[model samples]
Target: MASLLDEILFETAGQGPPPSKDFYQFFITKNEVIWRWWKISGRTEFRGTPPEEIKMFHHNFLDDSRFQEQLAVVFGNKILEYTLGLCRRHFDYLERLPDQLLLKILSYMSIQDVGRLSQTSSRFKKICNSEEIWKLTVLGHCDMITEDMEMLAKAMGWKNIFFKFYYKNEHVNMASPAEEEDKANTASP
Candidate 1:
């Protein structure tokens, strides 16, 4: 586990794609990158050798090509870009929010706002069009969830159900959801 230095944004540890028996761990906190490793060898010279740790502030981490290459080898490019962004202060903090929390926050926004937010990024678009968010939207809009509604959602997906029953200014009338789906299907090309 990566030790928490204040608050960590990115962390991982492993003996990656391994043949050698050394363990490596690295973590990125808001202001620092800390890399730690332990030597695990049966050789007489390495016996009882202490674990090693290196800590560098964001700018120093960005400037160190050796450390950056080590990061690429262990963590890959996405994390490298993310850590670089952290160092540069181009903070993409919202993307780091847990999906559940982001979905909860999205559920509170009007559908129009969500539609606009979807255009801002692929991540937002995915969450905006996600089944979980649609389910929440449906539950929020309706006072009750009938057995028929549950069946309809299961069959057509929650987002489809929401669009079929309640998108735009349209609300469910005294019509069957299945019948509505049939009408919609037949009406489209």
Candidate 2:
């Protein structure tokens, strides 16, 4: 799996924070870190200046406080910390997993567990809320899912179907024909 991450590990680009107009981009790959910048200013002197770029190996990047400060000034501590983690080769393997596989994995988890997992990361949140996963969940909870139900699921959404079908059926089943049977048995005794 490590070998699969030989390409770009992390990358982001955006304009600097408030009070600044410059744009910045950075890329972290297995071999090097590349930082690029474009000067954006209303002043005439800065208008024609070409974009600048810096390329450094991961080892050099760790010791380059100047670039680290520039990164913080452009983005914030969150991006800076993530960049540093990438430099340290701390890759997020789960994040790299294909969404299809994640959907399969999430389908096996309970609804409560899936809800908690969604809160952990944006990727998990997306997968947890996806229609495909919800379809799987509905199918698993139902003893027999018919073609008409699947068509209805597509029209109304699987999550809504699960709630309406599962919970409504549960509530309907709960209300009282069983009480009559129990009463009859007790009256016989």
Candidate 3:
């Protein structure tokens, strides 16, 4: 079996507004984390002598308190908390899956389930709303798909075609704009 474990890391940098122009670069990896910081000195005499510093710590030796303290010192409490939250979601396997595979898997799901799954992520939302997925779904649910219907779906989109046929009601207006226009033109003087 393939190994499920994986390492994830990212880097972020920020610079404060002018007059207090502070710059920072943070890199986090599986085994180590590093932070570099510098501040622009507006002194004319010390033109090139800006204050700069760097701090690094191994992941193994980093306790929650120490990690939070260091992050707070460099990036403040808000960024520290946001980074921690992002770290928690780094190992999400589903989010890492290829789009083709995700679409194929979603094709097998019920329309309601697919709708719910789309709400989970932007990637999923795109796949779930795609014409290919909807075409697959329409094919799966329908026993007989006429060539004319297939042609119509290509023009109107599978999602629109599916909803039109599936939720059809006599009182509901189902005519395409082109058809409606044709009718109006034919009836007018």
Candidate 4:
């Protein structure tokens, strides 16, 4: 019988398609992108070998506990995790993240991501609807938000829209008077 470690290695090795140009082009789904990126990054971690020296040993390669550290440095864990989750391809792992951390991560993704994540599951919908996350997720795209967007927005309710509108009015530029009108009004005054 194969040793436990051997089985693990074997299983991981066959879990993905070979890294060829054609395979990467057609077979690499959004879900697979994270899996492949994680594996490549994990291989990049062997201390003796530089990232370039580490090669594709097998289809499966990710085994890095410290991957988060590198990611945290580059994108910030808050954003990185959220971006991964928002991709809607890692729902299982994404759902398992701690609520606070997940919420922080959600804040870093775009409105479209938030909309997609809200459709993933009821639990995700609840978390995505929170004022803190929803506020940051939809920070500036009021006009782009449509009825489809409001499926998630319903969870947030009118109060959220009112608050966002209030903030937008207070802070964002709404309009500039026409130059001619301004000149005419100024002359009349």
Best by lDDT: 2
| C-alpha RMSD values across all candidates | 8.7, 6.5, 11.1, 16.3
Query: Lowest lDDT 10-mer window, candidate 3?
Result: 1-10
The regions of model 3 sitting more than 4 angstroms off are 1-90, 143-150, 167-189
TM-score for every candidate vs. truth? 0.60, 0.81, 0.55, 0.29
Which 10 residues in a row give candidate 2 its minimum summed lDDT? Answer: 167-176
Candidate lDDT values, in order: 0.83, 0.87, 0.70, 0.48
lDDT, candidate 1, 1-189, per-residue tens: 223223877788877446668888988887889999888888999999998999999989989999898877776877788788877877666776778989999999988899998998898999999989999999998898899988988899999888777885454344668988999999999
Model 2 agreement with the true structure over 131-178: per-residue lDDT tens digits: 898888887877777999989987999989988877567667564678
Candidate scoring better on TM-score of 3 and 4: 3
Model 3: colliding residue pairs: none
Between candidates 2 and 4, the one scoring higher on TM-score is: 2
Stretches of candidate 2 exceeding 4 Å from the true structure: 167-189
The order of the candidates by lDDT, greatest first, is 2, 1, 3, 4
The clash number for model 2 is 0
Error of model 4, residue 4, in angstroms: 21
Candidate 1, 124: how far from true, in Å? Answer: 7.5
Give one digit per residue, the lDDT tens place, for model 4 in 98-138.
78888888777755687799998898898877765755556
Which is better, 2 or 4, measured by lDDT? 2
